[model samples]
Target: MGKYIQQTDMDAYRFYLASMEKSLATIEKYLRDINGFCSFAGGRTITKELVIAYKEKLIARYAVASVNSMLAAINGFLSFAGYGCCRVRQVRTQRRAYCHANTQLTKSEYLRLVDAAAKTGDERLNLILQSICATGMRVSELAFLTVDALWAGRAEVCLKGKTRTVLIPGKLQKRLKQYIKRHKIESGPIFVTANGKAVNRSNIWKAMKRLCAAANVEPGKVYPHNLRRLFARTFYHIKKDIAKLADVLGHSRIETTRIYIMETGEEHVRIVSKLGLVA
Candidate 1:
């Protein structure tokens, strides 16, 4: 017989997280979100109908993108709380096409953002932002970073639940050493609050927004994920190999990586010849 997670199943929740082997941060987020829903549904006993209704309520005030993420988080909680398939599949089909990602920061735009971060003179912030742009790491990965994660001129990130290693530039390592010495960061996470807690992803996103404002760059183009896109764009331009880019980004699907290749790859002369206007 399994015990239900009531409004005050704090201990059970912690035990659940440990049993599932979820990260502390992930466990916190799910508890907060699920508890909110539980509170809203009158002291914890809730149904799938209530979950769907709350999702709808959220959709009215927030963007579809955000609502989808919230739903996913809640669904995870439901599963852990022993609801198990109680939350209906929000995404009806695997065949449904996902929106294409066209919001990529070009190479020049990427340079401008890096220059902006540098001009601010926030050593740790500068290193973190610049390194992500150079290596195309996810912001969450940056939050979880330790000095030991850097090895053999590569920075490894277990992104989207997959481990991928990024090649580190020589200049980056030298700067990292200098920054480490100046910050007196000898161990644990590289990015932390003054109290030494890990810097969360929201903090990094907010910092990027603040940096964009300081640099007079449009905020939209300066998103953290854009650095990953920039990395894919830069690599494809240099190597012209989608397979190689896919491997680096740790993408199992080559088709998904192909979209990151900026150059449509149609040779200029051949495109003109096909039009017959070349004659």
Candidate 2:
């Protein structure tokens, strides 16, 4: 090991943390995963061979994306340590843009989910679920939503490292007002557990699973992100305005929003069915 690294390795790691803009949780994960790999490899220097072995070990136990992410963390830390390869064989995998079929919840199915959430009669849960379906806000965004943000007539969200505001309709505004009044919630996050901590994302995901079952909808089609994607796809299909949809989603790049507009892989089948020349 070099004089600088061996004497101040942890400080070097601290510098890496200071130089980046990642969240605390992500920073913790990157540090922990890299430290774990280093311990397993039993090396003072981060070497290409060690990284290769780590990659193989991760692949055997985790999905490609998870493996890749851990590798990226290790690679970043190693590079900062000044002992890593420029490129480590460039792990490749066939990544899908959409994890589920474009079930595109029919209006009735959408209503059914809302009705199921309504049956919970928690009032806060009902409003949160309804707001997500109505506005296409991410569940994480809803988890930290504030009364001020709601009444401001806009969605000010920080997602994908970008912060922007999304406009709300007058009708949604009225409904939100009524819900807030009924729940007697004045400040802090809109959705909180009985313990008063903001509702976590895991619970919201579980709620979606339950709601899907209650509505008799396919569990496969009921992820939290699906509500947002369905909003984008259904909105574009109805309005045919890509720019407007992009603005509402607060995407700086219309191209970024286009990925959401693309239909499921099944669309290729639809094209094959209609195009006789393909046969």
Candidate 3:
């Protein structure tokens, strides 16, 4: 005996999330996951068994991490709707030591993408790509990169109730200053559309995807987050300080930072081969 999930429950949950200071992106994702579960429920009374069944369905269709993410959303909503007994456990997965090779974006590929953007004369895209890669900032944090922050050499990014300072490299700072001057962007976000609103993640993602063919990079590897990973990898190789890198990337856990800096399987194999244990 459980209450039927109603649209009112969903609306209230959304408002609750917003009140808790959840980012708009996070709220939307949670709602999307909840909506997906609702469709699966098909108006059936919510129950633990039904939630488990939904979890299994998700596991079959999505990757383990994605499945867990969806489950997290459902669990949160259930707690909010007073259906905590219906919450289902996320599937367990071992942490991956190396990232999949197919998705790893190499430095050379990143430069080629930047060059391609320049060739297309999309200066905004070109700078956006570089800014994320160089600063290792999330695409969502780009809005914090205003002309004032550029002059100050660091941007204070606030997200998910946590604030972190992202430093702009000296070289990148000079380039962005020139861009700001050329565009007469006296204040506010450095990146914006014709309407002067901060550019959204979807637009940045699409712009990056369009450069794949021209850059000779795989479409799967062309994304805003991949640039952040490239930055993490580069920083780790040079500094060899995972803790410092974690701080820079605004990761609350070093484990999350480890995922960002994972090498491809090929690189992992090559390094393991050099151990001389076989000889």
Give the worst 10-residue stretch by lDDT in candidate 3. Answer: 1-10
Candidate 3's C-alpha runs over 4 A off are none
Stretches of candidate 2 off by over 4 Å are: 1-21, 24-36, 56-63, 84-89, 93-110, 158-161, 195-197, 217-221, 239-247, 252-259
Q: Which candidate gets the maximum TM-score versus the true structure?
A: 3
Between the candidate structures 1 and 2, which one is better when assessed by lDDT?
2
Instruction: For candidate 2, write residues 10-31 as lDDT tens digits.
Output: 5578666866656555778887
CA lDDT of 159 in candidate 2?
Answer: 60
- Candidate 1: the clashing residue pairs are none
Q: Is candidate 2 or candidate 3 better by TM-score?
A: 3
Residue 131, candidate 3: C-alpha displacement in angstroms: 0.7
Evaluate residue 191 in candidate 2 and report its C-alpha lDDT on the 0 to 100 scale: 76
| Model 1 lowest lDDT segment of ten | 92-101
Task: Name the better of 1 and 3 by lDDT.
Answer: 3
Number of backbone collisions per candidate:
0, 0, 0
